[model samples]
Target: MAEILLPLLVLCPLAASLLVFLSAGRMGARAIGTVACAGVGISAVASIILSVMLLSGPVAGGLQVTLWPWMRVAGLSADIAFTLDRISMVMVLVVTIVGLLIHVYAAGYMRDDPGIARFFGCMTLFVAAMLVLVLASDLLCLFIGWEGVGLCSYLLIGFWYDDPANTAAARKAFYMTRMGDVALLCGLLLLACATGSLRIGTVLASVADGRLPASGVNVAAAFILVGALAKSAQIPFQAWLPDAMAGPTPTSALIHAATMVAAGVYLIARVHDLFAMAAPVMALTAVLGALTLLMGACTALVQSDLKRILAWSTISQLGYMFLVLGCGVWQAALFHLMTHAFFKALLFLTAGAVIMRAGHEQDIFRLGGLRRAMPGLTAAFVAGASALAGLPLVTAGFYSKEMILSGVWHVHFGLAREWTLSGHPLWGIALLGAFLTALYIFRCVFIVFCGKAGTRAAGRTSRLMGIPLVCLSVLSLFGGVIEMPDTLPSLHLFSALLNPGTPLSHADEPVWLVLAGALAPLAGLGVAWVLWGRPSPVMREIPGQAGVIRPARTGRGMDVLYDRVFVQPFRLLAWLTRLDIPGHAITGTGRLTRAANAGILGARAGLLEMLAIRATGTARWAGHLPGLFQNGRVRWYAAWIAGGLCAGLAMAVLS
Candidate 1:
């Protein structure tokens, strides 16, 4: 039953996408939206059922259902299999539930667009691909889904093909992720070569049992880490994600925030043993995550665009997840992944409503005083923003983020025997990141929702858009209750369901760390209040100075550096290949061919004229000989006739 049902989770959306695509020209927007929503909704239901069953049943090794024999070679074999474990169950639920909600929201969001059917089609396919990726039992199968998501992202990101900027953004995202995909593929190949199989379970088991060497695991893990970093939009590869905001807002919600950006974290968590085997790589992951967290937080602080602000926030949040994973807390990282998905999706969806209400204006400075007109949206935005800001005890982000910080604190202090006052450097950096997260998110909220109404009139939101916001807003606020820290005895539902054996108790946590965690967001909120919450002359004038905000707006010169170093050089090479090399070769070949043809034609004409002249000369000479033979007309004729007759007779006698 699980076997048949699990594949349906992947197949339903795929079939819906196909149906939508095939009937695109024939169907209206309403019909297309129905098909897309129904498909994802059904998958969400199935995911719920699977989650229930897996939770009730024995889920250690998981319930593996082999659909077919995918491949077979000398010492290698793989199957199109699905694994329903605790981790996968959480991922699938988040994907399908949030995916279905976004699809519903998009139905209203994109109703007026002519290309709504195409948008829904690509969106549905994207969900299916992610489902396939999460449920896949083998590395090869996962890679197929991996590339599938990449393809779908490109299609959806550039759905408005008329816009060159959107297309460019899509291409940038595709190429950047492809670089990581290549690394992932290399890692997969290395794992296959080392273990003689591409089955993820087999590889993990081998690594756990010490069947594979540490060196090989380290190399493979390093390659996979690069791939994960690129996919997750961490650090250098992160420039594409902010630009990806060129896509529709719903796209920003579903792919960029909720599912796709988190795939790298999922991949790392999924193959954690490989990382654990390589101590150096694990440490590097921690450092990278810490660096990205600070970078994202700092950049997000000064962004005026609402979506770009959230985009940078996502990068920063993902860094926290990676930081936890690197610190050897996979479950904590996943917990953060779940909570972040709920709130971030809510945030983006609400931003979409805000943008629509503002007549498609995305600049936070321009969007002001909508709290009264659209109370529901304003409340929803506050909920998401509060969660994002990690406001005290009420929001989901606070709990999840605290867990990661706790984990980091433990790893840092637990390792050293000395009870020094100096905490881990990452802990301090992470604390600062938390402060910035609170400050930036609230800064946008206060600027956009709290101030005087700007020029744009507030547009009405449809129930389709309003309902998802309401639902997600509720989740964002109360979702933290599920994974309450061990200090609280009543609620450990998420921890128990996800990690039954290992209880994360806070009693042993350092008191100073807890104090910092509790105070960081408050401090940030206080700072933001002073900066944006209260009307100030400085706030008004700061927007005009390009020098003051340009660095943060441009991702602190990372984009400039990338364009100068990577994009420009690549463009030059591409120009040479596309135009210079081919153009010159074609022109040179045409010139040489024309010159040779001209010489050949000239030679032929000269030779023909010379032959004609020679023929005329021979004719003239023959005529002169006949004249010489006949001095007088009669005498010449008689001599020629006699000579001809004598020659004929002599020839006949000789014969």
Candidate 2:
């Protein structure tokens, strides 16, 4: 049953995407949505059944389904396979279930749009690809799905092709993520070279048994870490996500909350065994995650656009997941991933409805007193905000966050005596991020929903939209009860479910840490109420000091840095190519070739003349060989590839 269901999970959506493309606008929006929803519904059901079966069996049980032999090359045996263990089980549930809800919400959100068919096609394809990412047992096979989602995201982000900015944003996202993808492919090759296979289990086992040397482990881990960093939008790679909001709101929700950004954390958690052995890489991850957390939280505090606020918040929350994963508490990372999915989805969807009702206006300052115009949306927004803020006892975010905070408190990382890091400072950074998370998110909520009707609004959310909000709201508030701390019931159900035999024990939490973690959110709420809950003018001060808001809003100039370092040089090379200099050089070579042939034919005096003509012809022919590969239009693309190869070689030589 599990075997049949496992393959069916990916096939269902794949078939539906094909149907959507085949239908080709002949079917109405209703029919297209029905097809997409039904496909996702089947997948969600399959996920439930497969999860039940995995849990019901022995402690180490999982379902590994192999479809066929993918390849056999130079001692490598790779298969197209899927694995449903506890970690992937959690990922499968989130991608399928939350994805299904988002699809349903999108059906209503996009009903009036003319490109509904194309939208559903790319969206369903996105879900299918994400499922492939989480479930694959082979690392190389997972890259297929990894690139698959990148393609779908590009298509969906530019779904409204009429807008030039939308297409540019799509291109920007594609180019930035491609950098990480290249590094990831390199890491995969490194592992394959070390272990002679790309199977996840084989790689982990080999690395654990010391089959790979220590330096090999460190290099592989560093490469994979860079990949995850760009994908998850941490620190240096955080610029693209805010611009990614050029897509539709539902697209924003799906990508930010349930799927693409979460892929990085899932990949890290999936291969945590490798990270545990590389202490320096782990410390680097922790430091970067903490930096990104503070950066994202601070940026969100100053944004006026509602969607951009959520966008920055996603960056911050993912930082927490990265933080916990770096600290060797991947289960806690995943727990927050789940809870973050629920609340983040809820918040994005509700914000979409709010924007729709307020005449497509997204600025929270321009939208006020929605508490009167749309009461239900106000309540839903509050529910999501409470969870995002991690307000005590009832909200799921608090428990998951506390789980992470606890893990951070106990973690220690260092490679040698000269380079050591305690969890205390990073934990402090995380707690500060937590406080800013509460302050910024609730600031949006209060300004948008608490004031008197400042902007006109009409047309409440439809039943289709409301249903997902209601379901997610409940999940956002109650999901963390399944995993409690030592002071509580000591419920290790979440951890226990992941690794059946090793339930974590945590009875000795420090008083100050526990007390501070619980209070940070509440204190932030109090500050927000003092600042935003009343009729006060908007403040421009960033966290810790007075600073320029524009820089924070633009991800603290990371974009400018990248543009200077990466984009400008490439643009210069492109402009030089578009000038057609290569084409002219090729034409000159053709002229030289013809002249040399003429000289050769004309040479008939003696052996000396013949030898000179032959020598000249050989030189001309060799020069002409260079022109054979010049395509004339934009050699920039070819140059990029050649440059990449050169860089790779340089790196090899340097190493």
Candidate 3:
């Protein structure tokens, strides 16, 4: 049953994509929408059933289904196989369930667009690729899905290819992720070379049993980490995501919340053993993740565009997941990944509803008093924002975030010592990120929904859009109950279900960490209310002043620095290649070749003319000598013959 269902989860979306694509010209929008929704709908149902079977049945060692031999070479082989385990089950559920909701929302969101069928086809294909990625049994198989999602993202992001900016954003995403894909490929090769196989199980077993060397593991882990960072949009690679808002709102929700960006975190979680072996790389990951969290949180604080704000928040949240993975808390990172999927998708969809109603104006400063115009959307927004802000006691984000912070605190403090509030630098960074997350999210919420009505009037949201929002809103609010902290023991169902062998333990956690986590969101909310809840002169003056808002909006000069360092240099190289190298050097080669050819031709012609002139001169000289000799004097002939004989005798004597 598991084997059949596992393949069906991936194949359903592929079949739907093919159907929509083949029938695109003939099918009406209704039929296209029905096919698209049904495709993902069936996949989601299959994922649910698969999850239930994995949970209830004996799957201590994950269930693997091999479809065929995908590829083989000397000393290398990878199968077209799927693995159904705890981690993959979690990822599949999030992708299918959240992806289905986004698809449903997109049907309403893109209904009027002429390219609805194309959009659904790409969306379903993206879902299929992600399913393959999560369930893949080997690096080779995973890479196929990895590149598949990258291609799908490019297609979907540039879905409206009429706009130059949209095409540019899509290209940017494709190129950037490709850079990481190269590194990921290198990592895969290193693993295959070292472990003699690309299978996930084989590599993990090699690492576990000390068959592979530590140095090889470190190098491979480092390379794979770069790929993860780039795919996840951390620090240097993060500039593409905020600009990725050029896509449709549903595209934003899908990429940011559930699919492409999440791939990075999933990759790290999947390869946890390699990272654990390379402690130095894990430490580096921790530092980078901490820095990225701060970077994204600060940037989100000043963003004016609603979608861009969510985009930055996605980067920041992903940073938190990386930080946890760095801390050797794979379970916690995945926990946040799951809960973050719920709230983040809810947030983006809610933002989509607002964008639809407000005449497509995304500037939060321009939006106001939407609390009354659309109550359902407003409620959904609050739920998602609360979860994102990590509000205490109720929101899902809090539990996941709390677990991460606690993990960080525990790791930073020695195992011999109890958890302490003091001397832990990472704790401060994580808390600061949480504080900014709460402040920025609520600031946008208040400014957009709590102020006076602006120019755009609120329009009615469709039932399709409202349904996903309500469902995700519920999940955002109550999803945390599954993985409640050990501080509250009764709601530990998530830990039990996902990781029954390792229960949530509170013995090492101090009371202060939980207290600090609970207070951070409140403090942030207080600051936001004071600044933006009322029409303060400072808030009014802040938006208009470039000096105040530029740093945060520009991602604190990270973009500027990257442009100067990477973008400018690359652009110059491209310009040189296009104009200088080809235009000057290559074109100059043609001129040089022509000049050499003409010079050789002229030299050859001159030499032949000179020889001809010499030949004519010799012939004329011979003719004159013959005329002289033919003077017809017997005496002269005799003298000449005697002189010739004498000269010949003298020459022979001398010789």
RMSD in Å for all candidates = 10.6, 19.2, 6.4
- For candidate 1, lDDT tens digit of each residue in 404-483? 88888777422224542223788888999999999888888888888788847556899988899888998899888777
Off by over 4 Å in 3: 412-423, 535-538, 541-551, 554-559, 571-655
Q: Which number leads on lDDT?
A: 2
Best by TM-score: 2
The digit string of per-residue lDDT tens for model 3 on 1-655 reads 8778889999999999999999887998888888988988999999898887778777376677999997788889989999989888899999999999999999899989899889899999999999999999988999999999989889988988999989988988888888899999999999998888999989998998998787888889988998999899997788888878787889889976677898989998998988888877887788788999998998888788889899999999999999888888888888899999999999999998898889988988889888888788889999999999999988999999998898788774222236323326887899999999999999988988887887466568989888999899999998887777666664666666666776655666777788899899889988898888876523732454477468678554666777798889999999887776667877889999999999999999999999999999999999898899889899999999999999999999999
- Residue 505 lDDT in model 3? 58
lDDT of 2 by residue, 1-86 (tens): 87899999999988898899889679998899899999988999999999999988878878989999999999687899999999
Model 2: per-residue Cα lDDT at residue 255: 85
Clashes (candidate 1): 0
lDDT of 1 at 606: 100
Each prediction's Cα lDDT score?
A: 0.87, 0.89, 0.86
Q: Can you give the lDDT of residue 21 in candidate 2?
A: 86
